[model samples]
Target: MLPKRSISKSKPSKVWSYFVKSENGGKCKLCQKFVKSSGNTTNLTNHLKRNHKKIYLNEKQLEIGKETAGPSNVNLFNLEAKASTSKAKFPKTDSESKYSDINTDERMDSGSEYSHRSPTPTAAKNSDVNVVICTSTDSQSQSFVSQKGRKRQQRIDQSFSDISSFSEGGNKANKVTNAIIFMIAKDNCPLNITEKVGFQYLMRTVAPSYHIPGRKTISNLMDEKYEVLFKLMKDKISSIKHFCFTSDVWTDTLNSRSFVGVTVHMVCENKLLNLTIALEELSKHHTGEYLADKLSNIFRHWEIPLEKFVAAVTDNGSNIVKAISILLGKSKHLPCFAHTLNLVAQKVCEDDAIHEIIKAVKQIITFFKHSVAASDELRKRNDLKLIQSVPTRWNSTYYMLEKFVKISEDVGTVLLKFPDAPRMLTAGELQIINEIISNLKPIEQVSKEISGDSYVTASIVIPLQNCMIKQISNLSPATDIGKHLKQIILSEITKRFGEIEGVSLLTIATLLDLRFKTIHFNSPLKLSHSVMKLKRLIEESQNEIINEETIEEPTKNENTGSIWDYHMQLSSHDKRTRRENGKENNAGINELDHYFSQPLVDRKVNPIQFWFEHKLAYPVLFEIAAQYFPIVATSVPTERLFSRAGNIMDPSRNRLSSTKFGRLLFLNSLELIGIYNIQIK
Candidate 1:
């Protein structure tokens, strides 16, 4: 036989004709390379069984479905093809009739038509994948229609029309609103602002087009998106574990005191995380109870159990202690030790001799500050020591003491060098100069002690170094008269500062072991209330609050106003007497707060095991305290949080309707509520 012409060589009309008889071959509809009978058909059937069995089986299912679908005359699958098809198109002429009768076996050999790409008869049998549903074309109707088919059609069509109208119309917006939805979903690519353009731009591009507005429109959209982000951020914060709060209210340049409360929260770790959670503007009229109530509500909203709170740290204040007790449940108070020591120095130095000594030293300092020549002369002296400057305040008291130690000898030398030095040495000044001279050995000793093995509290060295005198009662002085000074240092060091102040929790701290055994100051008659009480006193001191004073410059010409500062106007009197004649019981009570706050020395074996190893966890201890005392100490990490919150949700851009602000507090405070742990941060 002549080599068979390739299907590609056949004319299109011949190929169509050849396809007719080949349909009778009963081959597998797909992979039509084989005939469906005898050897070839058996192999083809096995191939379908191995590879296309499910698809082939589905065709069989559709064939049966077609058969059962009502009647032969009403084939639903073929309805569309049949509805508009004309019966008249069948051959009607004699030539047409004769061609229809020709034998058709040879046409079976040709397979070109079976290999074409049109949807096959078998494919049409499966309707689900083949069904082509149309969408609605109307978007002018402003309503949420549920039909996906209708909406898709309307949206896709309108997008183009919308776009065309904007670009085409130029002056007006299209009927439909053009916008984008900024969203934060729970999965991949969690947050987004789909710069979706409206109908005007959609219609312009043949394919779907987006409308990007002018600069102002972009800015407005960005602003809106920012709002969504704030809500999410606010929510994320509210979900944190617990909240820790730290707050401080102080005088500003205006002399108006404002209370700023910051919240710290726990995020992924113990490492301090988010701070900008809640930065509540505490009203000046508010009391501790009001603060507690406000703070309690925020904690309640976050669902962080308030009972777990460690303690609320505050600048010493009683009302705040009371409020923290009420809100977070008692045992939630931790007085800032930093402030407590300042007041201690104040009470201790208030004695006539000590105060005058300090003033005399300061006078020498003033003399030098006033005249650099004197400072230079003193600095050049062999015995003079230079130390860091310490600002005076309760917090600065420790540092100021250290500063004085540094330049003390220099000052004394300056006084001795200048007979004309306005600051003449008085008896108290002499005592102070003596004290200043006495400090040289201790200063050198503390310098060495600072590096040697620590005994009681390392926290003290740096802080004490900052103050009136370092190693006040720690190291024994080697001077011939240093034995007395050494006794003073040891005796005071023996007294537990925390016990003296009444912070019971500090027993676990290093304050428990301080050895205060000096014979100079007499012991109290009876042990006083908890040292924590003093902490409370310092915390809650609002008695002489300079409430909202307007600070202004004093008049330059008035002696009473400018020339005479409160510090400068006070007359210096030499009253160095500390007589113990008949005032035995009230030795320093007339000038001090009250009785001794230190815990009495306990004479028991295993005091460590005896004191600690209580069956109760630390948190449990607070809970137990709550049952008895009205207040509880807390950590209140919130102070750390709100600081970070301000930056993250920048106040300028992170605006919210007040309701949202509360939510922001919840999110940030929840984790920070680790204050719930009853441990110091």
Candidate 2:
């Protein structure tokens, strides 16, 4: 081997420098022997041979380190201060090496304490450079290294510094608690999830010192949140002059308890507010009188005027219909249009081929869901898993079938692996599923559009009704499934929605939509009747406004010449001229006439926002629009609330009290509350 240079042959390493400067410096890396920090490796080689005898690579590793320890590596230990000044050098004697190991404990105990000793004669010979170095002998070793001590002490102090910086005076802790509560309320997680060891460990990882509260504390927090939200809801509902309600009944499968969910829809500050006002558990029988009494109590509790309840939109259940008739009148009940369409979809799904396809798809989904081994195998084969559909909701079924068709090949392969696989879909059956999806896609789109809570869904009812009929008529009759499904859906639509064409409430809502106006009505007579009804509503609203103004006008002192007085005079003149023109012009001319004559609003424009923007121009008509526009075409908002309630009061949380369950649902739907408002755009 070539003569080893006093340099390491290992690759240039920043990591090796850390070890060289560590407190364990001067000790052999492999054998823990104390050696001189100087270049000579005689003692280090002997220690490695004796201690690491069985390790054959020790000799090679030592040689590599000996050759590669260059000037760049020396600065790592701050040894240049001594090495630069010393022109003369002394090699390590055997006694010095032995004494170095002997005084290890004493040196470690001394830590950063420094002492000074005069330099030797050989070092003082050339020039007085004051070279500082640590020697093995206690009598010879002068001062402890000041620079290394400071750096090491800094690192030690940093590790245990105040942990308060990890959190911003408990703001981060509060956010964590808020997120936990939201998940529990939103997903209906069990209250005891906070108690789990794994969950606690996870929290500790994020905030090691934070004390997570128990379930009871979380319950109290939620109750406080609900109270703040309820006060807000009550204020919003009481402030709005008119509102339409949707109420539906749901029975908890776990406890056999029935709940009546009531959602209030009204326009407040130009944005549509769909708030679930009450979700009361009813012990009484669901008779029309009892339900009507329950509804009356709710309105009474909220301090909403009975007359201000414009209409009640509900499912076709006779008891609900009769209850609304008892509370208001028969004319005030608007049957849910989406519920009517769901009935139509149900009628179409009665076909045998469609039924069988749904059954096979359900089986495939159940197999993977219930069997871990089969699910694992399916996961390996394809990423898309089959989704099971709810029988009560036709749109869910359509989506499930759509996904099943997309991943049929992987599903077939995965099914063959299992002994009890569902029967593979036949060619004819596959065609039927594809055809059903194509036919139901348009209907599904219409359902989702009208079920929306944010925008104006009530206005879309008439246009979608007309659009669906035209779409069904235009479908090619190439497939028998398409032809049969179309006939069934069309007949159901005409039967359920045809009579709705004359419903003055729906027609008024459609006319208020800048996108539809009177154009949605196919018949000239329907348009004429709708326009007549809207004009009457506007006139009645105008008279009410005039009466209220007249009552307030006498209380204030009159001014005829001020700027405000001049503005009032211009407004009075404008209204007087319009009234005079109304008498002089055609008998049917009103805001509706002018609105209809104006070009139809842009298709992409929001009708609710349009009416809000123009409320000042046609004040009476806008007030009337508020009454009809908030009437939903479906009781789906109330139904969706029940779905959320079901998740909250699921089997694990079945023992949860009704009051607490209702409160959680209230907070979950706070985004829909008008006081917790969002901009329309």
Q: Which residue runs of candidate 1 sit more than 4 Å off their true CA positions?
A: 1-243, 253-257, 265-279, 297-305, 372-420, 423-474, 478-681
**What is candidate 2's CA lDDT for residue 545?**
62
Q: Which 10 residues in a row give candidate 1 its minimum summed lDDT?
A: 182-191
Worst 10 residues of 2 by lDDT: 74-83
Q: List model 1 lDDT by residue over 285-372, tens digit each.
A: 6677777776676566444567544445666676667777787656656665434444444444454555555565556556667777
For every candidate in turn, the CA RMSD to the true structure comes to: 34.7, 26.6
The residue-level lDDT of candidate 1 at 621 comes to 27
RMSD of 1: 34.7
For candidate 1, what is the TM-score?
0.35
